[model samples]
Target: MSGATILMLVVGAIAIAAAARRYNLPSPLVLVVAGLALSFVPQIPNIELNPDLVLFGVLPPLLFNASLDSSYLNLRANVRAVALLSVGLVLFTTVVVGAVAFWVMGPSLGWPLALVLGAVVSPPDAVATTAIARNLKLPRKSLTILGGESLLNDATALTAYRVALLAAVGSGVSVVHGFALFGMAVGVGVAVGLILGAAAAWLLCKLSDSLVEVAIFLILPFGAYALAEHFEGSGVLAVVTAGILIGRKMPKMHYATRLQGGSVTATIDFVLETLVFGLIGLQLPSIIASVHDRSAAQVTLLVIAVTLTVLIARIVWMFPATYGPRKFSKRIRERDPAPSKAVIGVLAWAGMRGVVTLAAAYALPLTMDNGQELKGRDLVLLCAFVVVIATLLLQGLTLPWLIRRINLPVDEDQADALAEAQAAQQAAQAAVDRLEEIAEAELPTGSTIVDDLRTSAESRANAAWERLGPQDESRLETPSELYRRLRRDMLHQERTVYIQERDSGRIDDEVLRRVQRELDLEEAMLDR
Candidate 1:
């Protein structure tokens, strides 16, 4: 149907997901099933999406936003494991998959093309795995490894895919050249991202208006990606690099900047995720059409082979690759943290494919360089669909159960403590800044209210600072819980007043904007 129909489907799916969550079911699985059922309805028109729009338009910003939200400093602290998994592990899986697919399904395609297909599906989607991983109580190191691997492996897989595709298209490709290109792509992308990220942050700092700061955040990802891709570097890598740079600097941001910026970014990410999932669901019909000609037995075999290939490849790579470097020296073991077996198992199972894989596969040209209609293109699409469905539904659904069965408990107490301490520090700092501003402005001598406000704010600041104590303390007490409760009540009252004022036309647009930002910040802080 129209774009409105697509919007409705997404809304309906979100409602179902909420219901499913309340019932302790996997919301993603519910969404997938609902999407499938909706797709079969004759009245719902098939979606014809531009691959460029999905990849360039949708993927870059999503990648950037995810990067921005992640803690780059923490990610860097565990860089070794992340690198091993993202680059080394991805290559290992691709080789295993390529070899197996060639051996088992070569009758469907030639070796080169089958290898290309294997490379295509190798990278795990960070977005999907992180969702499930976040729900589980895994070790911090393990979470880092999983999240880091998901974020970086896309660049690696994409590089390999490009080489493989070019070779398949009769472009001459040397092993040395391919390796050089891969290295160059990553190097260039990272360099570009860092430069642009720093520049964007500098601009945001100078720009006082919250909306302008938000707009800068929005533009950086696309701008970085386009510029990198134009220069023959990896856009995915560029987006991620920019994100990491920005994220590392986020804590240093001013309170107003952090609040408004985070609010805007979260809104964008939520909307983007909804659109991405809905678009993914909308592709099912075309996938079905591709596999329509295959016999049940053949379809079943292809599905099983691809499924097992993905499953086994991860297991094979994770165990030895994780432990191998440790054997060289105890120093390495000391330097590098290891993932718990249960966490490893959960990560292995969390390899759900999503928008990136689908976009890449569907983006395949209709013909090869030889002007021949692409053979087995439909089969590749079918297998990719099967993998996406199986992983998103089966593994995604069972992941929480596996984590619990293995007794992997997450320690969010640490997170809460850190958040509280940070909040108190920020609030105190904001108060100090406000007091300085009031002093500089030289308020009227008779204004007792301003003096009273200043004294109260300064008192609160001093109280917060005393409670925080020494920086070395493992735990610091905070008035944050009480503060949060009071703030929530304050927001509720303000919201009620704002609604009344708006209805009575007593507040202007500027007033509404200011109040809206306050409400948005209060809601976000309360969310978890």
Candidate 2:
């Protein structure tokens, strides 16, 4: 595509997202619908999703950003559930869906291509799930499981896709051989990811430059992915691993680096999400255009069948995967009681296909190893596209409604508030002790300075505790809240003066920025 077209696409997706927010609809739905409609316009080009660009160029960052936001501790806590969804359920869905597709499409489609289609649509998309789920007020554990599953499931799905592709190209892969390939991918991918993650963590710590540190994080995901894939391992897993590791260390990095990295990551995430979903929509026209020889009825039958298989397979897999452990193991019951059926219902319905499905469908080679055209490649692509849209429309649109109507338990905001208050109190006490120790050691701790410092720490702790109190607007403004309000006004004045000085040529832009940043940090602490 031309530069003009790319610019238009970005602008259009942003517009769609804005409109989606205005109307309280999901951005993914709006983007896909807009792209599908635009695809039919006579002036538009036949923009296809390039498999190599998406898998190599686009996918790594998307997965990396999601992993960065994910809590390593939370993922570890829910590892069992995530594993059931990501690894076990994905493989099961691939076989069940593959069996159905082959049985329906018959020998013409063949087992290998049939399984390839299955693998293509097997996992719920990380981008889609994260995009939609985070907005809704699901339980914390539910969010963790969904985020963790989406992060790792691509590894299982892609590995299956790779194995199936080998079979399709007549590489003579058997059940035993496929399992061996999977084990190798997991082992190698994890190793590469850890080695790269450790190197990145070290570099980030050693480097003090915020720009350079942020740049390292930005490049690390792509490099890890490429390196892992070069060794015939899963790139998705490698990128995710590196991102999670780096994210955990972000808090320890320089504040400037944290702020810069966060801002850059959020911007990239918004732009990429909008373009990708819209691109998926633009695909419908090309998918339809490719089915020249297949009869309309046959195409219709296969699309519905495959789409149903994808939808139903998730529901079938999730309920058993959820409750089976609790029923069989007494320890499991005590440790993790079963969630309400309503939560499980929502989980089952959250199975939307996206990036991997779209890229994997297009990634198929034109011909097998023996040089014959890869039969059913067109149908596979068609069915995969149908499944993607069908799930997005059906599940994405209704998810909010289902969640609201089900009255799912929300995260413990009150408990979280209490924890914050406790932590602040303890930290304040620690600070006070350190100050006394410094004063006793004959540091520049004047009586007035020490008193002011102690008072500031106490005020911060009081602000946190106030949140857990009554929140009536009629309540009088506490000293802490009043102090914050007064401090914000002071910060504004300080920034105004700095800008005025810069405008009058009394100070350079650098000086203005330095002063403004100091004021900004001080102002930020008030809110905390």
Candidate 3:
């Protein structure tokens, strides 16, 4: 890509994404649509998604960000569902899709090539699924299942893709060998991830500076991916492992680091996801150009047949995957009860594919073992493109409607507010105890400072408790809300004076920045 195109891609994506957010539209879907619309413009440059750049450069951070935002607690709670979707479901989809492709598309896409296509599209896009989940505000359990499934499913799909590739390239792979390869990838990937996650946690703990700590956090994902890949493990799993470990460790770190880390990661996700979907759309012209060998009728038939199969296959798998284990295995029945059918139906519909399938299609070997161009190479890319577009357009657009119609049994937001109140009350009590202990040991008992700290803690806790009380406009402001309102005005005045001091040359820019940060933190707390 040229500099102009790069600039256009970044700027266009950001602007489009911003608009999407303003309109409450799915940014990924909008970006993809924008890119597709832009692709036909002769004045616009042809945008090529380099397979290596995407897999190595693009995939790791996106995977890591998804995992980082995920809840380790929620994941552990729904491990069975996650595993069923990530491992069992991905393999099942591959076999089902591959068989159907071979049977329907004829010898043009033989068993090996058919399996390649299957593996490419087997896993739903992690980036896409999580984005939809957060936007839809699905129940906690449903969100956890979707997030966890997306987080781990890429590893399964990619591993299967490699095994299929080995067969496709005439490396003479057998079923036993393929299973062994998959096993090795999973084992090694997890091991590398755990070791790296521990090391990253150590490094994060040692560094107090939020800036440097976040920088290290930024570097670790790519490093974990590369290191794991170097050892012949699944890079996807390695990055995910590191993310979950780091995420769980985050609560122990300084709040400043947590605040800064959250902002940094959110920004990175926005930029990367916007660019990814935009690229997905822009490749329409090139992807279509590559499929000169296939007739229009043939391409249409394949696209329609495979797209329907991919959608239906997930719906078919969810029933057995949800109930089969609980019926047969006492462990699953005891630990993890089956989710409602409505929830399972939502999960079945959330299978929109994205960048991974596209990148993997391009990652196919350029030539066969005999040194001739690989058969059906363009066909695979075309199939991947069509499936991605179709699923994203069909499923992504209608998912929200489906959720509303099904109405999964989620408790309202009041449940979250009540939980916060309970935690806050306990925290306040802890603070009071600590203050009393210190006062007895060092300061005279009932010192004004101790009294003030105790009151502050109580006020913070009571504000939370007040959320459970009357919230109508007719109600008076609680002590905490009143303090927040008046204090915010005072903070604004303090910031104005600081800026004036800087403008009058009484305080240097550095001093002004330091003072402004303090005021900003106070204001942010009030806003929260």
Q: Best candidate per TM-score, number?
A: 3
Q: Write the per-residue lDDT of candidate 2 for residues 1-528, one digit (tens) a residue.
A: 777977988898998998898998888888998988988898888888888877887789889988888899999988999999999999998998899889888988999999998999999999889888879898899989999999999999999999999998889998999999999999888989889998898889878899999898789889999999999998899999988998888787898898888889888888889888989999987899889888888678888888988888889999999999989999999988998999999999998888678999999999999999999999889988999999988999899999999898785888888999999999999999998998778767467888988998898787888878647768688666777898899888888888998999999999988888888788776765
Better-scoring candidate (TM-score), 1 or 2: 2
Q: Give the better candidate number (1 or 3) by lDDT.
A: 3
lDDT of 1 by residue, 65-95 (tens): 7788777667879787789888987787777
Compared with the true structure, all predictions reach lDDT values of 0.75, 0.89, 0.88
What order do candidates take by TM-score, descending?
3, 2, 1
How well does candidate 2 match the true structure, expressed as C-alpha RMSD?
Answer: 2.0
Candidate 1's TM-score: 0.84
Best candidate (score: lDDT) = 2
lDDT of 1 at 261: 76
TM-score of 3: 0.96
